[model samples]
Target chain A: MGFLFEQDNFALFRDGFLQTIELSALSALLALLLGTLLAAFRVSPVPVLRAFGTAWVTLFRNTPLTLLFFAVTFGLPPLGVHFSHLVFAVLALGGYTASFVCEVIRSGINTVPLGQAEAARSLGMTFGQTLTLVVLPQAARTVLAPMSSVFIALPRNSAIAGAFSVGELYSAQQTFSERGYSIFAIFFWVACAYLLISATVATFFRFLESRLAVVR
Target chain B: MSILNRPASAGVLYDAPGPKARARYRLFGVLSVLGILGLLWYVFAALDANGQFDPDLWDPFQYNFVQQMILDGLLATLKAFGLAAAFSLTLGALLAAGQLSDHKPVRWACTGIVQFFRAMPLLILIVALYYAFFAKQSMWALVIGLTLYNGAVQAEIIRSGVNAVPRGQGEAAYAIGMRKTQVMASILVPQAVRSMLPSMIGQLVVTLKDTSLGLIITYQELLFVGKKIASQPMNAAGFPYIPVVLVIGPIYIAMCLLLTALARWIEARGRRGANRRTSPAA
Candidate 1:
């Protein structure tokens, strides 16, 4: 503990923490959007589209995210399609996560009653209009909690960025340890960073939940 | 309103997709097409630029070094996974039972174990355990770390599965003079097992993937072998990095797919039995 104070690399720690936040934000946003779209495809009227979406989710959901990261980082470069490790990390994380998110969103959509869609159709709305007008709102309520937890998962997984030398919180701590910082102190700080981020997000989700309850 | 019969709202949350949704779909379709085309173009360009598509550079199965390392790594990985899977399921059940215990100490102790272990990243746990305990460490640390973390997750899954089996069923069992332990052993455990099977298998998939983290502590897992292979400079491609990844990717995918299929089979069988018991005879 005293070592942390004496070393006083709080500035470096803060910058590393900020990079983690940036990486999380970008990946999460990209994942949610891609996931929602894939969820739509999974529940599409067309059988082939649904099958394709299911296969995509099944493949990604089954394979490990680390393996996927390795694939993107190592597999692409030899084909003369080199990406910065950071870019590849983000794409891999976002892409793999979106597959799980798609499953969550599809379940959310399923939770919404069929009557809502029928009612929308009775209003002479197109299928897309009916879905927009009726189904997604209710599904959103049901999925909010799980979705928030998935967001929490995103940051925890951001630690994998360290493998590629992305200089996130975990990588920072790894560097500190290599530089003769006490291993315990470095790890303790890393854990604290992860906890802080996760707890903040969990609190925000709880707030969102209560607010949604009030609306209901 | 009932869950199924509620009227839809007009807000974005309530509303489904409309013309804008169709347009968005079309846009994504076009984009996907372009993306695939671009990938194909890149592949061709790489081949043309390199003026050769060399197979030997990347085929680890063809080389004695790569094959030996991967085979050894594969066995080590399986060893860790097998031990962890058994430990996790057993430990998970015990912890799950403790969490649901009437006694406060047991519940608190289990909760603390579960939360702390689950919250810490698996890599850190592996490293910590390797350093802090087990003289040789070997596969034992990796197994213990995986069990500690995944067992916690499995405990939660089992607890929830058991809790979901209605309060009335437990009450009914107790009223029939069945002891608490008996009720849990005979009724709750069986029912929860069925409901929890898929999730447990899903956790196992996670455990299998995590075996790769063994690379950090030099446990010689598949990823470790891949890394070793890539660090060498024996291939004609000059950049055998991509080939190593491509070679290894399928191996991981194959293992995971097998687990997934097994889960689906068990789940199907369980559903059939459940349905047979519940439905009226023909």
Candidate 2:
């Protein structure tokens, strides 16, 4: 609490906290797209696609995010692929989170009636066309809340960026600690920053959820 | 106009994987998979080429040091996870009861703890614990952090499970003069336990994986062992980092999958038990 009044460490907070938001927003977008596609494949009639999707989700979801981040930073270099720490952080966070999002979307997809797909096909729509025009829209509507939760979850998950030495919010906090900043103040502030971002994202999602629910 | 011409064949929905779409999907799938394999090959090849993968490069795995480190790390990981899991579940039950309690402060406090902890990242908690409490050799840091965060999650899960049980049963229990604790422990929890068994196992899976965070605090867990081994693999193999990752990754995967399969089995047995009890009702 006393550290809140200390103006020196405020610079770290401004930069590091903003980076966290940026990283989270990017990863959330990437994860949503990747997850939606994977969930689609998981439920697709193609057995191979379904198997591929399941394996991907299970592998990523089950592994600790720290190890995954480590794998990205340390594992890829030998293969002649080098990502900046920021890129590694986003890719690992996005890729890992996409797995969880896939499960959420799949659950939403399951809730959708079989008759809708059947009805769309009866209208002579291609599988892709029907999925895009009919199934996805409704599924998206149903998943609004869960997806919003996932979005809120992004900052928490982004904590792994700390491991990459990516200088994100948590990492910056660590630097301040090393510099002899009060541990309690730094952590308490980190917790508050997390709470603020989470509440904002959650409230925004609730608004979107109600909006979609009304349309339904 | 677009809504009227839909095909009427139910078979088309399941059966008709168009030839072009099927072929294209397969081609893309095969190519992507092959690309992954090729990537792996390139990794190993480069490591081999650099003489970094030498079999005799460094002797970190010499009789005592590496093995002892791994054993100690594994023990710490297990200890932390065990304590955290037990504490979290107990805390979760208490929190759940409070959330369901008639008292507003109790409910609000429980909810606040759950929300606040759930919102804070587990890694942040671990680091905070490190700085705040255990500055040195802090297994307690890891354990407490994991417990605080995971306990909140478990509380929510248990509460949801209990809520899923119809309301009439609770009212009936109250009518019979059963105490609140007795009602919760006897009727509500057992039923909720059966319903939430899968989720509990899922959280356990999460707890197991999170043990790797012990690495940040230098807690010498499995990944820590792998890292040490990779940097200094004995014999002629150069730094076997990727091999270490391959080894560790699958072990983690195997453990989680085994837990998942076990959860599935328990859920099946639970279903049978549920059916047997409810048979008369049915």
Candidate 3:
């Protein structure tokens, strides 16, 4: 445990922890936003929008995030598309995570009641207005739990960003290994760090759920 | 405008597009196609600018050595997944039994392990297992780490699956002089498998895909092989990054899709059998 407090280990681990947070947070947000768009497309009036959304979901969800990371990190550079490692990693994470989030949100939207949308239309609300004001708000409430799951999964998944040299928490393992520290202690501490993160996020979400649980 | 299709809508959610709306959708559709084509053109230009389209760079994949390496990598990946899957399922079953134990302390310990593992990232777990136990044996580390994390998840699945069995079924098993273990084996486990097979297979897909994470530990998995191929210039081009990824991406996607399809088939079979076993009322 004292090794965790050692100056070199402390700094590297701290940076790694912070990097993990940044990677997950930004990418999760991107996934959520893009997912919402895809979900909307899934149920949109336009057949083409619906098809495109479905296609996007199938394409991304079927593909593994590791492969997507490779595609962005290795594949895109050849195509003259360039970004910082973190940005590219985030894009990959966001794209992959979006497929899942989209499915979750679309299911949430389904639970909003077909009658609700029909009523919104009957009340003279246009498609966009009905979705923005009525459909999505209710869907948002229903999907909070799954959405949180997706968010939690983002951080866990972001560990792979280390492969792309994103300098996140898992990357700290390489540092510890290189530094001649006991692999046990280094791993023990890293596991504890991840456990702390996941546990904290989970508890926070649990607290929110209990505080404002949807009856359904 | 017949009431049959509903006066306003063609679907359950929204009104069918009127002529103007249809025209607009067509416009958007055309724009979408144009946009995709434009993006494709841009990517092509960018790739061509970097000599990524060079025929010479890709021709080497026709050789035996590279092909054998990839197949070997694939087999190694499957080997790891198989070990991890079996161990995790067995571990999951034990932990789930412990979690559902009548003894409070046993239950508590199981709960703690599952929660800790579930929350812990797989990468950290692999790294920890590598350093603490496996030492330089990266394969065991990857396998064990995957097992712990996935086993924790599978515990939840099993616990829920068991609990999902009708209370009457377990009580009846007990009434028939079956012990707890006998009841779990004879009654609950079978039903639970029927219900949980899809999810179990889903987890297997995750497990299969997760084997890719071994590359970080320098395990010679498929992704690692792909990386080696991608990085080697070997010819005039700097690296065949695009070609390697293009080749590898479809292979992974195919495997996942196949796994998912297999799960669906099993689920459908389960459902049909269930429907047959239960009366039509069910």
Tens-digit lDDT track of model 2 for B219-241: 76888777777776345554566
Q: What lDDT tens digits, residue by residue, belong to model 1 across residues A115-208?
A: 7777777777764665666777778888988899788888877777777667787767766766677677777887788788888888988888
Candidate 1 regions with alpha-carbon error over 4 angstroms: A46-48, A80-83, A214-216, B1-52, B134-138, B273-282
The candidate maximizing TM-score is 3
- Please report the TM-score between candidate 1 and the true structure: 0.87
Residue-level lDDT tens digits of model 3 in B1-282 = 221222132255656678987888789777877876787798778878888778977865888999998999999899999999999999999999999998999999999999888887787788767767786888999999999999999999999999998899999999999999899998999888888889988888889889988887788999899888877785676787788877887888788889999999988887774354565474
Clashing pairs in 1: A128-B17, A131-B16, A131-B17, A132-B15, A132-B16, A132-B17, A133-B14, A133-B15, A133-B16, A137-B13
The C-alpha stretches of model 3 lying farther than 4 A from their native spots are A210-216, B1-10, B175-177, B273-282
Which order, best to worst by DockQ? Answer: 3, 2, 1
Candidate 1 docking category?
A: acceptable
Model 1 chain A poorest 10 in a row by lDDT: A43-52
Best by lDDT: 3
**What fraction of the reference interface contacts is present in each model, in order?**
0.21, 0.51, 0.56
Alpha-carbon shift of residue B265 in model 1 (angstroms)? 1.4
User: What CAPRI grade goes to candidate 3?
Assistant: medium
Residue by residue across B1-282, what tens digits does model 1's lDDT show?
A: 332222233222223446977566567666665765687698778865663356656555586876888888888888889999999999999999999999999999999888777777777667657765753865888899899989999999999999987687899999999998999999888877887899899899889988877766778788878878877765455656666666777787789889988999888888784354463554
Using Cα atoms, each model's DockQ against the true complex is: 0.28, 0.49, 0.52
